[model samples]
Target chain A: MDDKDRELLRILEENSRLSVEEIGSMTNLIPAEIEARIHALEESKIIRKYTTVINWEKAGNAEVSAIIELKVSPERDFGYDRIAERLSRFKEVRTLRLITGTYDLQLMVSGKNMQDVSRFVSEHVAPMDRIRETATHIVMKSYKENGNTLFEQQEAERLPYSF
Target chain B: MRNFVSDRAREIPPSGIRKFFDLVMTMDDVISLGVGEPDFRTPWNICESGIYSIEQGVTSYTSNRGLQTLRDALSARLASQYQLKYSPDDEMIITTGVSEALDIAVRAIVNPGDEILIAEPSYVSYAPCVTLAGGTPVPVECTEEDHFRLNPDKLLEKITPKTRALIINFPNNPTGAVMKKEDLEPIADILSDKDLLLISDEVYSELTYESSHTAAATVKDLWERTITLNGFSKAYAMTGWRVGFLCAPKDICDAALKIHQYVMLCAPVMGQVGAVEALRSAEDEKTSMVNEYRLRRNMFVAGLNKIGLTCHVPEGAFYAFPSVRGTGLSDVDFAERLLKEQKVAVVPGSVFGRGGDYHLRCAYAVSRKDLSEALTRMETFISGL
Candidate 1:
């Protein structure tokens, strides 16, 4: 039953629009089995929201993305998580990873253009209380983003099983 | 939102070699041969050109492809030295060093699930870049028997229908093996036959003391399928300047140039000036350094051999890849012991690829005095072990 949930999660990742029957066929399971597994996976928060994976370049958005590394200091009482919560409220923060390096937080922020990005950094990211220093790399380009996903068997081993 | 992560992110391990170096940095009296970079500063002539460019205010971004003069100089130098010809305007891009050129090469060509054939125990970037580009990195582990050269037969064995490109880096990092024309021709033919592209990194091209560097484009038919990456970093001692050029057919160059432009409007405008000067005035710097490196290479190899550490006489580049097999330890474990016990910092071969389990790379580009001290420390460390 857990293996089926892992399969359902993987299929959903590959194509969020996969129908119950199509997913089961792809995973070599019956439709009724797929429906039950998908329901369970979705209920468990493994399959989050179905998202439209648009190739932004092809979508005519021409949005310029930039990465800004921040050295933020949360208030004396509040910890880093509280500061992260405040920052994530901005619509532009795509992904933020609290890194273990010279910089405390690496923000994958993007905006329509340099002006919009600069506005966000100066007004919001930079002025945050206790931000020691901010280094903006403006991800000139990423030849490759991390595309490594564990194979299905490995994924199954990683997850807890009830059955 | 576009995915920030991909499937390959989870497949391979983070660079253990880099991690070890970070750990060893805190240790005292470690004679470390572990850092992969060279020891020299940018040549004086190159530095002058850079200063002059800044003084002249050539600071604004140049054309996306790069400065016309630098590109022409690179093309002329490549043709004169290596018998390769790429049109400066149509087929070259000035990038922010070979790192960026490599990034563009992988991104411009590879699609998800494609396979990248790498001659292992070679350059470190080939596999990680391939994984990041959503391609499978199939390492064709070259052995000490091959002097770490990519065997054309081995390359053929690694190719499947899904294979996309073969990454070739000669005067190779860690191993210092340079592939001569005679050695590369068969691989070129293979590329032609297989309809595969070649990402040839020859950043150390000028540093070869052996036969002349072989450009992949020197092959009659492989020019279209070859993307050549070279830089002033290794040969001209311009590592910090971060200037590299990528040359390929116009279409591929165009695609890479788009990414190059967006990423770096130009290779440090000053670095371009330095590259032009390095090509124009520093024939002596290349020869003199190669001569010094050859001397250091001999000293390093002999020292290792005397201490019962076996080595392949590195044909090019500044690294001496020697085996640590006698120590009864894994390459990583041996490197740790060496750094902790002897303070000799050399990168473990395992960081490069499999079959590197018994080896380590010692860069001999440091001053002869430092090299001598390092050798002494290494010998003492090994003897104690």
Candidate 2:
């Protein structure tokens, strides 16, 4: 991507909430003009959905997060997309990315305890015929979450602007 | 064998502010100035009224136009504050916020491709709201050189055959500029003979510092065609309460109420009660808040100027728009780098409109304690830049 487009992406990757006017200021384009460029970016599939990132840990919810690996038996009739769709309907799955290694999907799930995790597997996941054999790894410590976020670490200080 | 999504949906990228806030949400010790909402609680009397409303079990919907008492309070307050008159029963409707008011007004009036005049840098909602309502948002860039007021000549020149409405927002967001009656006179005159309407946003009307606010509707020939928007959010620190108001002619209110009746049904019932309490009493609470903001604007402008940034001494609203030229970086770069380095957050200006080049808008609605510490950190950071 060119510098301007990359700059747009860099900013967007940082905050999808930035207004077209604000994005234009960053790139020296007028709001109406930037609106057009932003539209072009979306058309190119460079800019995706705008989602809020919540600090759930600080939101008075005491929970544990773990990334589980699953090897799903893809249905002959519906394929992997249907399997992924079915797996995604749960609220605990923070993310469920299909991958190409020892596991078919890398799942991020949060729970109150080990029993909660076990129940999620027993009731919701293992019961599904879109069959999946799973491996669980509780994150002992997150030096980093999602490449550059501070989501993994424990801290005592109160955060500004509560969720 | 494959279906495709249209290029139009694909072309528009999502908002950049959302992404940055997400990242900021992750990192540690991030002293955020990112959010634009006020730090103060909705005033106590207002909160009590809301509680009273809930306790009295007034949970069901009010009239589609809203609680009659709150509308009367709003009409009386508008008269007391800006000398504008409206028969609240006929002219006003309680809305979700000024944002929704803009929506219903535009939808009720403009046709597809109809041009709506807006001054920039302005609130982020204006253009997008206009576009969604199937009208063209023609931004007339108001400059800092002209004290951030819309140039009448530029505005007059931009008017076209398709121009159906003019949206005036003051004291404007981002820049915090308010237009005096003198500034509104010419535009009012021009519209006298035209087939057009005025959607005046006075959400920040209660916070003016230098001069008394003059509602455009108070200017003769303007009131007849004007749809005035004001809200409990800014003046009462009730952003989350979700109550605002709109005043226009009976015919237009009739059309807007239909769409609003289906879309919103009614504004939050307790919110309407809280708003009435806010409007009726604690006049000094409003005064005290404005006084504090006035002090903040003075201090902020002085500090920014002392640190080599140039900002207009704003007349109203609670933000300071400082030119970020001394740092030798673009406004966006300055904002990103400042946040990444110093851990202080401020919105870059262009987000308001094209009129906001080389500027950063700092909201002073945060606590003075936070503002003080933020300034100290900012000074050290800008010195290095």
Give the top-scoring candidate (lDDT).
2
Tens digits of lDDT, candidate 1, B156-246: 8888999989887888887888887788888988888989999989888887866777777787688889999989888887777889989
lDDT of 1 at B131: 82
In the range A35-103, model 2's lDDT, one tens digit per residue, is 777789889877767677565566877578888888888878877889788889999888999899998
**Cα-lDDT of candidate 1:** 0.78
lDDT of 2 by residue, B1-385 (tens): 6659654344334564665566577776556665555666667888998998899999999999999999888788788878888888888999998888888998999888899999888887788778777788999889988888888788888899999989888888878898998888887887776767999988888889889899999887888899999898888888888898889999999999998999998999998988888877868788767766765666567667877889888888788888987778988888888788888878888777777878988887776557767777788888887
CAPRI docking class of candidate 2: incorrect
RMSD to truth, every model: 26.5, 21.8
Best by TM-score: 2
Top model by DockQ, which number?
2
